[model samples]
Target: MKKIVLAIDSFKGSLTSQEAEQAAAEGILQVYPACEILQIPIADGGEGLLDTLLPYLQGHSISLYAHNPLMELIETCYGIASDGQTAIIEMATISGLPLIPPSKRNPFEATSFGTGELIKDALDKGCRNFIIGLGGSATNDAGLGMLQALGYRFFNKQGEELGLGGKIMKEVASIDTKSIHPALEEAFFTIVCDVINPFCGPKGAAYVYAPQKGADEAMVKELDAGMASLASVIRKTTDRDIAVCPGAGAAGGMAGAFLAFTNCLLKSGIHLVLEMLSFSRRIKNADLIITGEGRIDRQSAMGKVPYGVLTKAQEQDIPVIAIAGSIEEVNYLNQAGFQAVFSITPAPLSLQEAMEPIVARQNIRGLVSQICRVIEINPRVISSSPSHSKFSSFKKR
Candidate 1:
């Protein structure tokens, strides 16, 4: 092949997007040593988003001390670009579920204060444009803790300031935005959200996600009630109703808080990342495009990295192939536009063994190398055949 583009997502617990791309490149080079390969690490506004977008945005990391979900101090970092006018904050870096052990996971006591602290620092540094990724959060506070860190105050009926944690939402009877950060008025936020859960309700943040963050049936109901109460207070105070907004529940209603309190817009994670990266323009002349994530299932066709990359490649009639750690619904994925779908695993193995970084890298490299050999033997098999025909033949194997 003349030119190939590797636009792959992180393999979750194992390889990062860059590492996965590097492995794929190594495989391609084994067959075509002189081929031009372009690697673009990608994430759909989740854990690895900052690292994926920083270089393209001409940004640098800013490390600082921030509070974890349990209110403990932890060293964390965010990204700043365009001479500090723009900031990229991934919620997972600060208040993510992984930071808290399973034994310690408690949405009621967890807080998003650290995420707010990052934003506050960026604002102080003259950042008025914020790209915040709302994913993998450990709290269900409706962003009360975050707003507090940003200088907004919440008070109980006794006129007492409420402290941090999701439980505080139930006690919040009044909101005081008068002392909010002055720079907030000039700020614009772009929230990257993949889920469409509303701020409060049966399908909302607390009910659907709090359980995973250590809430039992009783705690879930309580957290949901608190979220509802906070939503009411937010509506009354800001004249903005975020209770039913799609994606408002993401990151434990953090998106709702930004909608209620700031000039912000919510966007689909993958689409926003693709647009920011100028994905279509970058792959305009690519002979082939390879994209994948940790797994490919029915959801993979729904705004995930591989689907997003496939759509962009389709616009230019470029054939796209996908390689994942595991795969399901192969027929559906083929219908979704991939010229071929492959699982990098060479043998039956347990999940833990499959996820080892070295093993994953080697498997991906070997898989891609074999794929390249097939292409080298008969270039027309991929370049000239219809997408469906190519996928159909591969499925038989």
Candidate 2:
């Protein structure tokens, strides 16, 4: 019996990492009943992290009445591990783009206070190590609200306290951290980040990413100015120019805030997830390793999950195949060590239609089945033409 390892990420809106693995396992076992299947559900430290990692830690979620950017009441979720030593927080869960309607999109009015509330809740539960996912955020407050929730104070020029969200940043004249949470000094904070955007510049959070969250030119300008204002205040008060730090722009300046206040270290989200899941151990000694995401393209070769897995598998000389919802630049993917590439779409269909949950699962099963069938007949067929022909000629010689 051959051994196969399935290490896959969540298919976003379609299948979870575990569900995807089981779907592939069921399909593979139907054809190759004797095959050994290893299921490793992986996450890139984003939205589906709870779905992928909670099971590993025996973690459960708790909801809190947190404040949104507009100071509106919203119930947000954060996870706590069974051991009560670690907590998982996805910033998007508290200050996500979806929480505010498109018509209400205003980076100036969004706040990270809800995320701060999650952290506070975790602290109350005696969890000292926090792994925070800093992606898909909807604010540019430079973490002012978060700091406030953690016992810092923000004041305006008139010595009056500022309000929540970036709109009030323009009025921020000073920050006082004398009463910060005592446990924060003892906490281990790891920020899972995807981009390396600096805090304030032409390519900064407000300038480059705010527009995507419905910030207009005016709102972008406002956020940019507000971030600059906050940066100056923090520099004067804390002697740290966090605005220029790498990855400081992540999650609408939440990264910078964490760095400055909570003493968090930023890391590649995929790398962190892989380490947590022991992905390298699973890839070792596998005849074949399969991994994929929602889409595969030039971007996949970057720090995405597929790229991360391929890099590790290549170290062991293990062959890998990618099954994506859609594929572009197949040649580029070939260079990334994908023995073969597959698209889950069965026919001509819109991306939305193809990404339908049930359809994606079935299509993934079908693709995995076909790949297994081909591999069974000729294991060498997984190689590309140049390599396959070279090996074939060697065999003949």
Candidate 3:
């Protein structure tokens, strides 16, 4: 491995993207002392986006008082680029399920109103270009609460404004969009999403994601029905049929509402992020690319971090290897494009022990060192150049 690239996602509770990439780089250097190694810290358009983007953006953060999932006040922040026109907002910061205690988790009771406040706050900061990261949600109200905060009114059969909740959506008769914030007309939104589930049905938002937010079987059915009914209303009022739109279910139908209400586009999470970070230019001539996430499973093939990185690496015919905290149901990963897969756990330790920062780093470094040794002894990765040190050169920026 002469010219190598390391682009790994944060290992969740263990290592951040930078830390994991550093660990892998250290191990690779242990074998190939003079090899050129490039590290690309990466995220799947969700939790780590703000951290990874700060360097590229040279930006400052703006803290705003916003409401949580249960409509309680809290202080959260968004990123503002040095140019001050671009703002990056993560929806999970305010409305994510993790913020609420287990005893208080309830999708119907939760609201996305706080998420809208973040966007509005960014607008007030004179940001016209917005990147919205949609993940880790706690609500199943079809983003009705968010729309409400944006000044879109939901009226019932008697023309009285309805309260927020998935169950109350069944009583919605019409929407009044004449009062939406003026800044939205001039703003552009790029939404980052991974799931392709639609607005309603067995594969839709409520049935596919609501149960995780404290919804029981009956509540899931109720929320699903509400989503179906709201889709019809959106079609009648906005002329946009989001009922079967891909990625419409993301963040509890937040994507669908953004599609209908804002001038925006939805993109696959990891691909969008990598494009923004100029990943292809950094790894154009790499001999081997190493990428991974917290877990590798059938779901990892669904446009997650490693799958997205592997897809980009394949364009240059670079062999790609993936490391994970654990591997499960990954029979098709290699077929999809990965050259190899390895788990970071060195022994039969429980998940909690494996996630220890020190232990995770040691395991990652040991595995990567061994893999480099194997590649070094193999003739396939050797370059045509006389010296292994002078194999390939790729731009860093």
Candidate 4:
């Protein structure tokens, strides 16, 4: 039986990585039941990483009490690996865009403090190696609130402790590390981030990303000013100009805050996921590999999951096929080593309609079925076919 490795990202808002893999697996089985199938759910270190890592770590989910940007208590979830030696903290669970109400959306008011609380909880659970995701955040507070929760203290001019939130950062007069958790100093943190935006100014988190979180023109200006103020304080205290630091703008400047406050290392999220999944070792023996994301475009070639997977597959001289929600600038993926690319949508459907759980499953199943049919007729097409050569031939014709 031929060994096939099926790796795919969660179809955002449609299906989880496990469900997507099952749907594709069902399709492949229909065509070749005798073949061996392996499922590897993927994430680019953003929204779906928790699901992706759960299978590897033998982890389980737990609900924790957390405060939103407004300090309103809410129920949130994080994961602890089976070994109890690691933890997975998805920032979106505590400070995502969806948690805030539309009218109340305010980047300056949002805080990563709840995220800090989640981390503290994990640390208390005996988790010392942290894999923190740095995407889908709704704050620009520079992680001061998170630091505060970890025993660092943020104070105003009067030496009064500031409440947890971005708005409070503007009044900060000092930061005290004397109370920082002892466990934190011994811990190793890996921040999975693909963004490299600076902390302040036009290109910084607040100025560049506040509008998307419901900040208006005026709010953007105010948040930017607040971020600038926070940066000055950080520069004065840490002797590190975190405001100009690359990736400081990620997750609304949470990246900058984590770096300044902790001994965390920033890394390409997709690359880190690939390493944790051990995709390199698997690619060595696979006959053909498949990978995809919610969308495959020119950007997917730039260190995204599909690009990471395909790059490694290329090293093994294996071929790759991509299946995505929609195809945009698909020709771009060819250069990334994809032998073929397929879009999940069968007919014209609105984005919302396509995203319906059942509809997405059906679409992906059908797409995989179509691919299986072609593969049955010419299994070597993906295994040995010259992708760019075919394009060149077509151009010549």
* TM of each candidate vs. truth: 0.93, 0.89, 0.91, 0.89
lDDT of 1 by residue, 333-369 (tens): 8887788999999999999999999999999999999
| lDDT digits (tens) for residues 189-300 of candidate 2 | 9999877888888878889899988888998898888888888887887788987888899888888888877767899988988888778886666777888888889888
Which candidate's TM-score is highest? 1
In model 1, the clashing pairs are none
**After superposition, which runs of candidate 3 have C-alpha atoms over 4 Å from their true positions?**
379-397
- Model 2 sits at a Cα RMSD from the real structure of 3.3
Show where candidate 1 strays beyond 4 Å.
Answer: 383-397
Candidate 1 C-alpha error for residue 86, in Å: 0.9
By the TM-score metric, which is better: model 1 or model 2?
Answer: 1
Scored against the true structure, residue 157 in model 4 reaches a CA lDDT of 87
Query: In model 1, how many backbone clashes occur?
Result: 0
lDDT of 3 by residue, 161-224 (tens): 8887666777888999889888889999999888999988999999999988999999999888
Candidate models: Cα lDDT each: 0.90, 0.81, 0.85, 0.81
For every candidate, C-alpha RMSD to the true structure in Å: 3.2, 3.3, 3.9, 4.0
